[model samples]
Target: MHDESEVAVLRYGHRPGRDDRMTTHVGLTARALGADRVIFPDNASQSEETVEDITGRFGGQFAVERTAALDGTISEWEGVIVHLTMYGERIQDVEAEVRRAHRDEPVLVVVGGEKVPFEVYEAADWNVGVTNQPHSEVAGLAVFLDRLFEGRELEQEWPDADRRVLPQASGKRVVDADAFGDGDDPGGTDADGGANDVTE
Candidate 1:
């Protein structure tokens, strides 16, 4: 059984890009933030196996839910974390649920590449990047949860806009921040240092 105290992460992302990259990032985020449940509000592009691969490593401590189903029931847990991946989707209903769940309970949102005007995300207690390379993508999500658990409001950068995910480059590209040991462009080093001599 997983501890109920961890943050509840509601993940939203493209299913096509479901790979070790995403799973590793989210797993690390959950571990860092004490997240116990991973809820999928929408079925974007991942399968059950994908979710398993993502959250299965942390002693299998995280629970996975496909969606939110409840009548007049909101915020049954301590907090609600929403992940909005697509550009056109709206968070009005999800926000309503969070508001209803706990007037005092905090609401944290992580937005993906979808282009949403400020007005839509302004109401969130905290906002973070869902598309940021490597583990930083969910770093804000972890911090916000930490604050809420401590009875504090979220304060985030809410970057000017979402960053788009691009196709992998052919050479010396630092595509993942965490893949190379957690730093901005950690030089072309792999987890095992197997591909360190490739030319730019």
Candidate 2:
């Protein structure tokens, strides 16, 4: 439905111990949900590694980066900046407009933590709220991307994947990409607890 114009996610503010998994999910969500890349805060190297590791096994062209210049990144960003917040304008009202604008330009989506600085609100081309209520940034981001792509991401194929999940009506089943031969599923990573969908 759209041309390639790069959709990137930037996570702002992080408390190492408190936000470890939350921050990691932000990157993972971005990668799985069709964003081209995710940029983590400088102190989030561990999160970067975790996201990269997932991409390696599950497969995609997703990239993970870390930056110390967050403020500058937003202020100097070349394309639209969307900041997700509970206090912002409702997402349903603005997603169509955001989608049109993003068609020809890169979109940098900002997901903040407990307290986003005032400058972010001002710098944003759009201050969007998935729901104007309390919730996780990961939820907000996931919903936003699904809407942005109009559910096309669910049909996305992962290239160069070492493993992939075969959808089942009941129990989980994962398979090695190359080992499926003669109608036999000889390889399995689901034993390692890898499933056929996004990690929750």
52-134: candidate 1 lDDT, tens digit per residue: 54343213445555554321112343455454433323333343444454444444344342333454444334343333333
Among all candidates shown, the one with the greatest TM-score: 2
Off by over 4 Å in 2: 1-3, 180-182, 189-200
- The worst-scoring run of ten residues by lDDT in candidate 2 lies at 189-198
Clashing pairs in 1: 6-34, 7-35, 15-45, 74-101, 75-101, 87-114
Superposed by TM-score, candidate 1 places the C-alpha of residue 39 at a distance from the truth, in angstroms, of 2.3
Clash count (model 2, backbone only):
0
Candidate 1: where are CA atoms >4 Å away?
1-6, 13-15, 18-20, 44-48, 54-60, 68-109, 117-119, 127-136, 142-200
- For residues 79-153, could you state the per-residue lDDT of candidate 2 as single tens digits? 999999999999899999998988888999999965898999999999998889998899999999999888887
Best prediction by lDDT: 2
